[model samples]
Target chain A: MEFTLISLLNGVTYGLLLFMLCGGLTLIFSMMGILNFAHASFYMLGAYLAFQLSAWLGFWPAFFLAPPLVGVAGALVERYGLRRAHRHGHVAELLFTFGLSFLAVEMVQLVWGKAVVDYRVPPSLEGTLFTLYSTSFPVYKGFMMLVSVGMLALLAALLAYTRTGLIIKAALSRPDMMQALGHDVPRIFTLVFAGGAALAGLAGVIGGNAFVTEPGMAAAVGPIVFVVVVVGGLGSLLGAFVASLLIGILQTFMVGWDYSIIDVARLFGMQLHSTSALTRLSLTQLAPIMPYLLMVAILIFRPRGLMGARS
Target chain B: MLEVNGLHAFYGKSHVLHGVTLEVGRGEIVSLLGRNGAGRSTALKAIMGLARAEGSVKFKGEEIAGMKPHQIAWRGLGYVPEDRAVFPDLTVRQNLLLGVKDPKAPGRFRLEEMFALFPRLEERALVPGGVLSGGEQQMLTLCRTMMGNPDLVLVDEPTEGLAPLTVAQVAQFLLEIQKRGVSILLVEQKLAIALDISQRLYVLGHGRVVFGGTPAALRENAAVRKEWLEV
Candidate 1:
């Protein structure tokens, strides 16, 4: 029972991290209908930026400073890259962002090298909060929770109450009306893209040290993040939140499910040798495909996604 | 004043407005009368620069043919689209906020002024525009344009799909707007409303202006109505 609780806590933490990264992607894509393939590359950039900032200015400063820096970079991309590509159509924008992601990943590798850089937890957040059934829950994980919740609140308030938020919400629902109302729709798009990039950068700052910071980390987590956005209805923040939690918990629990294919076969009165392909099929081998499977299932059942409007 | 001299507009390869020329003096309500598919809406769109247009389009002695829609709007031209393009997700207050495009010191309606003009909108400040009745949406669109405090407004089919009472209400609102020293380029299918409200009228057919004259002259010319307006 205690183990189950630990797993649940672990899942929630991980889910929140996924939410931090994916919330931006979902907003940018759903609202703007720009499939930003390089979104994960921005995540990798955030991690590296935090690492560089930490080396010079310490962990606390990196946390405070790196996200806004990343946001500026995102704004530049929106202004010069995405905005220019926008005139060519959504497909061109997608391709441009996809190329950007490739370029970002390569740039990170060139700057940081191909090795896993050691990124330690900050001294203030070091060590465990408590031990549960011989397993320790790190204080850093708690800190992560606080950050994610704070960010989620800030985002909610920004979307619900502010004038810019009101504009974004209206534009998301009725883009044509926004134009008819004499809004420079392109400027709004740039703001949203930058804001989304900043959110992804914030996730990277916190998650990089907790997870592994490496050049290839973007490729590793990219599909999973996209899966979260897809599972959450496209352009629906509520759906994204729910899907994040679901995927987070599922991925966490699947890690410890010990029953193998052979065990399942044995329960049905069958045997397989070590050399057999059936026995060779390991759980870890199937782990990466699990989210994709869920994504496909969700797509088949609800094409508009959980919170997406039919129109 | 607003003027279109040999204005040409197109949608892809198909020409939608051809050599359409007309004018509206300040404090005047001018109507564009045409049958369905006669390019009245396209002409309005061309003036607003929302549609692709060629040739001279001028407002207040300034060239506006190649300007963007927002730029044209910033220059005191308001547009009410045929479909009643209200921001469906926004509250009435928020919708009113988008209408004010100018930063000038004179000729702007404050938020409270708009509320007084459309009290229904003030009551529904927090309500979504989409849920409003058709007549309410029409009023909201017109009031939202007035919120920008534009000098000249282009209204397209404001009475379309409206009951007779609601249509009368809209007509009254347009008259009130005109009394405020603003010019209007009104597009309408209802001849009665156009003839009743407009000082001058232009008849369009097959993407061209077939006739231009006073509203009384339009009403008097049986051949013009029979050839261009009547189905």
Candidate 2:
């Protein structure tokens, strides 16, 4: 029972983290129709940035500082890099971001070395939160949840209440109309890219210690984000959030379900040899791949995803 | 005031507008009339910087040949596309609000005034633009452009696909825009509305101006309309 509760806690926390990173990605995709491939790299950069900043002025200031820095980096890339690639078409834009991801990984390795950094939680948030059944929930994980919830609230408020938010929401429907209405559309695109980068950075700062903070961190968690976005659908925020939680909790639970393909064979009145391929297929081993399989199934059946308006 | 001297446009390598030239004096309504493939739409698009153009296209006496579309819009020109291009996801009110050139400044039109003028829009102000009827979308498009307080409007086929009653309403709105001291470069297929509203008219054929004169002069000449404008 404690194990189930702990896994649930772990799942929700991880899901929130995924939402933070994926929310920005979905917004950018909806607005510009470009799947920003370097999004997770920004998250990785955020962690490394926080690590460097925390070394100088403790973790709190690093939290405050890292996101905006990543935002500026993203804006510069949007203005100087992506805008130029836009004329070549969507494929070129995708290639640009893909190349950017490779560049970001190389840059991280050059700056921080190829080894993992000692990016621990601050001394203040290092303690444990209230116990969940027999399992103790850490204060840091609670903080992460708080940060994600806060960001979700902030994003919701920004999109619902602000002028820029209204424009972005409108842009999702028709981007060309925005230009005819006397808006600086290129500037708005830059702002969206920057905002997405900032969210990813925030995710990185919160997620660094929660996961391993290393050069390979972006690649490790990056494909899963694509899975989240694909499973969430192309242009829906609510879909991203729901898909994130579903995938997060699902993968965590699958890891706990020690059932193997042999058990299914036994239920079918068949006996599998120990060395057979079916015998080696365990749910725990398939946990990481569950998202990919889900993506394929979703694509084959419901191409628009759960809440997507378009395929 | 706007002037296009020897304007040429290309959709990639396919040249569409070949030496099309016309003018709209301040506060004057000048209509561009032609069949579908006669480069009438291309002329308006070129002036708006939406199409690649070469040659002297001047607005308010300043050369605006290579300026971006939004930059041209910021300089007090507005375009109302033929399809009634409202942001479908936005509320009608939000759609109108998006049209305001400067949110901080009070433009020529008011939100209250727009709603008062078009009561149908006021009734459906909170509804998403996608759900509105074609006629309602036309009104929203006109009012939204008015919110910008443009010096001149480049209106393209405002009554296209609208009900006859809605067509009359659209015609009435075009006159209303002109009365408020804004010049108009009108593009329309309906000869009656163009002749009724325009001070002058230019008839285009094969990407060139076949006739450019007063509405009376255009009426007096059947040769130009039969050859260039008539099916």
Candidate 3:
């Protein structure tokens, strides 16, 4: 029971982090129709920037400044790189961002080296939040949840209540119409891309210390982020949120489970051979690939995703 | 209020509008009559900067030829496309609100005035735009543009695919727009409606102006009608 409770809490914390990354990706995709292959790279850049900033200016200042700096970098990339590539069509734009991801990794390696950076949770949030039986939840996890939930609420309010949010929504489906209605469509695109990058950067600020801050970090978490986006549906924010939590919880629980296919089969009175590798492989071993499996299932069953308007 | 001189537009390699020249006076309802593929819509797009065009497009004495669509719009030019490009996910009220350029700067039309113009829109104010009926969407689009309070409007096929009642309502709306001192450059197919409402008319044929005269002169010119307008 304690295991379930602790895993659920941990899962939620992890899910919110995933949402922080995927939210920006989904927003950028919906607005620009570009899947932004470099989004996770920006997340990595954020972590590295935070690591460097915290070293010089302390954690709080680094936390506040890193995301906007990443946002400015994203804006420059959109205005200079993606905008030019856009003239050649979607393939060129995709290739540009795909190339950008590689460039970001190389740049990070050159500046910060290939080794993991020592980024730690701030002293204030370093201790335990609560004890769940024998397991104590860290205060940093609680802080992460608070920040993620706060970001989500702010984003929702901005989109729902503000004029700029209304305009962004209109531009999502009808950018040309938006232009005709006196909106600078290209500028709006740049702003959205920047905003998306900022969200990812903010995620990295909180997530970097929680996980390992390394050059390989973006690549490690990148594919799972895509899985979350796909399973949530391509452009549906709500779908991404639901899928993030679901995948996070599923993976967490699976990682803790010791049961294998053979054990489950035995329970059903059809024991598999112990010599078979597939039957002997434990659920804990399969946790990493579970999101991909879920994505495949969702694609097969509901191609448009859970709440996606488009297929 | 709008003058297009020697405007040449292209759709990639294929040139669509060839030296199309036209003029719309202040508070005038000028209709561009043509069959499909006559570059009637292209003329509006070029003037609004939605199409790649070269030449002079002057709006209210300012040269707007090389301006972006939003810049042209800010110069007080509005365009309503044939497709009625409503943001499907936004609520009807939100759709109208998006038309306002600056919430602080007062426009010619208000939300209450639009709702009064079409009570159907107010009834479905909270509903998403995708679910609206054809007539309702048309009203919403027209009202949305009006919310910007543009000095001149380029309307493309406003009555296309609409029912007879809706068509009459659209005609009434056009007259109402004219009454508010906004000039209209209308791309219309129905000659009767054009003749009834338009102060002047131009007929487009093969990417050029084939006819330009008053409605009475157009009524008298059967040859121009048979060759360029009647399909």
User: lDDT per prediction?
Assistant: 0.85, 0.90, 0.93
Q: Stretches of candidate 3 above 4 Å error?
A: none
- Score chain A of each prediction against the true chain A by TM-score and list the results: 0.92, 0.95, 0.98
lDDT per residue for candidate 3 within A1-311, as digits (tens), equals 99999999989999999999999999999987879899999899899999999999999999999999999999999999999999999999999999999999999999999999999998988888899889999999999999999999999999889888888888988999999999998999899899989999999999999998999988988898899889999999999999999998999999999999898789899967669788889999999999999999989999998888787
- TM per prediction: 0.93, 0.97, 0.98
Clash-forming residue pairs, model 1: none
Put down candidate 2 lDDT per residue, A1-311, tens digits, no spaces: 88888999889999999989999999889888878898999999999999999999989999999999999999999999999999999999999999999999999999999999999988889888988776789999999999999999998999999998998887677666677678888888899889999999999999998888999999998998988888899879999999999999999999888889888688899998788776778899989899999999999999999887788
Q: Write the per-residue lDDT of candidate 3 for residues B69-170, one digit (tens) a residue.
A: 999998899889999998898999999998988788989899999999999999999999999998899999999999998999999999999999999999
The C-alpha interface RMSD of every prediction is 1.9, 1.1, 0.5
Question: Clashes per prediction?
Answer: 0, 0, 0
lDDT of 1 by residue, A1-311 (tens): 88689889988999998998888998888676866888887788888899999999999999989888888899899999888888899889889988998899788888888899877789999999999989999999999999999999999999888877877887777665566567777688778888889889988999999999998888988998888888888877888899999888877777766667787688899986667776766555655677899999988998777776641
- Per-residue CA lDDT of model 2 for B130-230, tens digit only, reads 99999999999999999998999999999899899999998888888889899999999999999999999999888899899999999889998888888
Model 1 misplaced stretches (Cα beyond 4 Å): A261-286, B102-113
- lDDT by residue (tens digit), candidate 1, B118-178: 7887898889888999988998899888887789999999999999989998999899989
Q: Relative to the unseen true structure, what is the C-alpha lDDT of residue A274 in candidate 3, on a scale of 0 to 100?
A: 67
